[model samples]
Target: MQAQDDFLKRIEKLNEIGIALSSEKDTNRLLETILLGAKELTNADAGTLYSATEDGQLKFEIIRTDSLGIAMGGTTGVPINFPTLPLYKNDQPNLQMIAAYAAIKGETVNVPDAYEAEGFDFSGTRAFDQKTGYRSQSFLTVPLKNHENDLIGVLQLINAKNLGDNQIRAFTIEDQQLAESLASQAAIALTNQRLINDLKKLFEAFIQAIANAIDDKSPYTGGHCHRVPVLAEMLADAASRSDYGELAAFKLTEEQMYELKIAAWLHDCGKVTTPTEVVDKATKLETIFDRVHLVDHRFEVLKRDAKIAMLEAKLAAMQGGDAEHAAQLEAEYNDKIAQLDDDREFIRTANIGGEFMSDEHQERVRAIAKHAYVNEQGEDAPFLSDDEVYNLNIARGTITKEEREIINHHVVATIKMLSAIPFPNHLKCVPEIAGNHHETLIGTGYPNGLTKDQMSVQARIMAIADVFEALTARDRPYKEGKTLSQALKILGFMKKDQHVDADLFQVFIDDKVFLRYAEEYLDPKQIDDVDPAKIPGYDVGA
Candidate 1:
């Protein structure tokens, strides 16, 4: 009756330990808790947990003992060579070893008389028991089973003490039952931990897939989203290695690095809302189709009209029998066609040059509008309207202020879309990181109009990377891509205007990060003409 009461108390203690394990999600903490509980419940001097390995071997995951001499840190329990033992599931052991026998049989094992059982084999168990200067009398071993009923590990308790003799006593059936109950609880906790880990991995992969999909959306921008993350990582790595005191202080941990990569990939996710036509806008006056082609048709009409006027004048002069008048009319007609052709040539080249409109160019374009025609509807149609000529002649800048707004709204859409995403707790900063790429220190940026204080270093790095990629991308539909030197020059001007961090730009250049990226990912021909010397204070030889 007394033993039964003692068993009940032990079961209550095991239940308390199980409750404690339930609260811990961290794998290391749970393993430690399991070992501590096993030792306490069995009154054992030492305990160890062995997890089954992929190769059908038992590997030690945790080992805890009462001896203060053994250093507990960094030792992952002993590896048992499976070939040396007659270990098979449900098979009996040659030696009456409690732990090994329980593992092989997939059942809890208890030994009540370890030292004085003549028929009981103790070949494998005796050596370790004798070496510890502690007589081993009782042993309790339980096989840890997962939810699938597969053996995950084994929990062993050693040197169970006898209450009356003050010596070790053999483990009883009651002890085996208690150990099995604890093992079952541990298996459930471990299974839950594994599920959580798998879910985390799935979430990360899903985010990466979304980033890849964004990159694959446009042919010209196919690798851009992918490249930004790579560049961001390189910059981060450089910052981490810098000797500069301030930069070194901002070192990124593994988790921060991961978050930064995710943010970088999704930085332009808002571009999805941006119209593809606007993104691929090639011509200055381009809408669905270029209106400049209409201008060419207008020039053709002027040529035809000039010819008809010459014919009319020549016929009237012939009626009056004046040969001189006819010759003069023919020359005048040819001159008008020549002048019109020259004007058309000028417009075509100017439109393609992609240079911003100069005041002189706009004036020339206004002067060409004098050759207006009377349409078949009796409406006077200027070869080009004053406004049409003005916009067409503006040469390289955007065609309309409205189009510029549409282009800039991509930043706004990006912020809105990212804000709607349900990022997990660890990734709560992702929306801020993705949205702040367009922000500046001087509050001159758009969308949220964030200042430097509201922006993180990750955001700043992304902003720089976006600008750099944009300036150097030859595949862009609108402007001719700048040479590397030109891109750097422009970036320098932007820095002077407080659009980007000057020090960070300098660090990025000095670290040769861009050069490394160009070599690895960019076409050699695209960057071949770049002269590092053209960048102020930069030495190509160095």
Candidate 2:
């Protein structure tokens, strides 16, 4: 009855060991658990676990000896310096070493005593015993096979102890069975964990590859795709540490941080569907090539018409012997030529994009549009088309309303694409966080136009990061990158307009997140010293 109770107790311990092995995520800790658990079940004094390498060798993964108080590898951080036991020698299976031979046979080898054991080499064991003044005996070598029946590793235990007396003895039949059971459970757990980790790495790489592809689609905005994540993480860390404000009550766990990172990387993923022509529209009239050159050709035509009229008058005057009338015609022709030249120059200046277009310049573009010239069909037409006039007079940046709408649809695309993905529980909020990067606190932002009350803190964090990165980014086509002061000033106005989270903007200033980002990504010229007091909507020293 005692013997039966002992068997049931060992079986219970084996079940518990299996549970612990499956629960462990860290590879090193899982390995240590398998080795130590096997040792405990068999009452072994020392043991070592060897993983099979692709090169046909048994690599030492963990080594522990309770009597000598020695532990190496695994969670101990002490590296195992011992050489691997080669499974093959000269293309022949190495059956000399007991552990290697057991792996080759795919079965457990139980030795009643290693000192008197034969058929397997124990010279290394004897040498280790002599150096440590310890007797080495009672070897039980078990091959760990996964569910596929492939040998994954070997579990070798040494020096089992007799419970009735403290003397070392051979591993029992029951001991061998328990060790083998634990080895099988451990192999399955290990294989599952490895698969999980590999899939995770593949998923992250795919996400980044999409981000990079979007960047590559528009060279002007490529850096924007990379920089926003850096700023997002920077602001996120600041928010995590805040003690007071909207974000003070909020905190992110490691899993949440990873989720945020994924969101940041994929925030603009919808850009993949955006037309490269619209995204890279560098000038007011750019499409494939700048349409301003077409307008430039019309100015040349006007000049040619003026000169022809002057030559005609000269010919008629000479035919009628009217030199005085011909001279007057020459003076008028010079004035008309000068005025056309000035008008062309004015239109050319208006064609280039700027942060703001004054009414005076816009009116000049309208005036230039009215000037007439002959078309290829020999019909009179305006020097600048109405459409050309409209594009040239865009009051803000380069993109016109129609093109702006096209650009804005990328956020919509991002939302649609990400919402369809069934993320795991930890990443369930990825679509929301990424989709909301373009939203505003004032409820005027695009797609859904979500307000501050509707937005999460994580979404707000991405907003500031997105805005600041765009402001200081030099890779854009329409305007030069802003100085640090200029970017912050715009952010301050955004805060005043309730377009950004007030507290997060304040945190952005107080923590100098902008400076941290500027130091790394901004051009030296764009890194000018900023006076926080002068920044619009920001309260310095508050």
Candidate 3:
């Protein structure tokens, strides 16, 4: 009957240890569980678990004791070294005795009185008991070993209780057996927790590396990805403050804001695949190479031919004694070349601005396109083909239709790439936030052609930011950078046309959000002499 009760008690202790180990995957929490279980199994007033360092030195991972006031509050961990104790090596008699005869060795060491133990060393244990107020009647230590028989740590239990005397008593064989069993479970849990921590660190490093790669791609465009997130956050903050009718309208939390910032940084990640020439398109009708310059030279040739023809006709007419008529023809030919030169100069200057041509500019451009020139074959040629003339006359934007299609495809590529990434649950919105930037409320946008109803607040903010930045950017090769006043004027026109959110633009201007951002982010030279108040209908508050 007593044997059955002992077996049942050991099983109960083992069950408790299992529950403790499985409660947490954290390494620190697992160590605490080991200490608590060790104390309970051995009926000790105090218990500690010491994990070995890479250098073979032991560090106290956890400490628990009834007398220690609920696990020492802040004294959970300590170093186990010479000042603490002379730890035993495997060859040491004390260590061997514990390993060979204690419950860890599949036997049990019943030390009735540790100070009087005949076959084991008790000096270290006795000294520890004397330093504290605790009396040591028994000392039980177990090795926490994993399935591979590798030692993970050591568990030490002190002052086994005597039920009859209601005082500290010697450790029993059953107590030793119980502690060893608990230690074994702790080893497995600790190993598993370490593995989890390592994997998490690796994943975080990978994410940081990807962001850095994106940042490093273009030298002139440095910090572009970094700044987008910051601006996105500011916009989101402003949006949330404004009174939108629906409470459930998409509002960013701190975590959501962080995710959106990450998404902003990665929004142009697909640009990696786009040719650098396209990204830095610096000339009118520039492709891999510019062909417009050739057209300009052809026009110059036609002007030269026209002058030579007029001179020849004058010589012929003078031969017939019509001197006044010949001179008039020469004067008219000179005037034509002068006008053609002026138009050519305007075309060259116009390409330098990199801005989309306005309707008035396009009309002027079509007139220039109709001007005749001489080809290399010396035949009469219009300055451009019919299609080229049509394209030049459209005045839709700086980008040609083909170039616009390529630029628009980036949004599609962004969505595809981001969707394939296995983002964490908190960052699941990355793809949506990135891909939806080009979308508009009026269904005129590209990639997905998503309407306003399909767009989120984040998407709208991104669109505004993209357009504003492009308008104000000075480094672009093709177009002259707009002054702040000019850029705002354009934005105002866009708002009036219902292309952008007027309310948000009003809020942006009234709050001086752009000025605030420019102070921190724009170069001092870029901000010089810029007057925010000069913007049309500038309001301090909207």
Clashes of each: 5, 0, 5
Worst 10-residue stretch by lDDT in candidate 2?
Answer: 242-251
lDDT of 1 by residue, 421-464 (tens): 88777677888887888888789997777787778877888888
Candidates arranged by lDDT, highest first: 2, 1, 3
Alpha-carbon local distance difference test for all models: 0.73, 0.90, 0.67
Candidate closer to the true structure by lDDT (higher is better), 1 or 3: 1
TM-score of each: 0.67, 0.89, 0.61
| Model 3: colliding residue pairs | 353-479, 353-480, 354-478, 354-479, 441-452
Full candidate order by TM-score, most accurate first: 2, 1, 3
The candidate maximizing lDDT is: 2
Cα lDDT tens digits, model 2, 250-284, are 78888888898999999999999888889989888
Tens-digit lDDT string for candidate 3 (360-451):
87778778877766667777777877755654544544466667678677788889999999998988988988888777767777778787
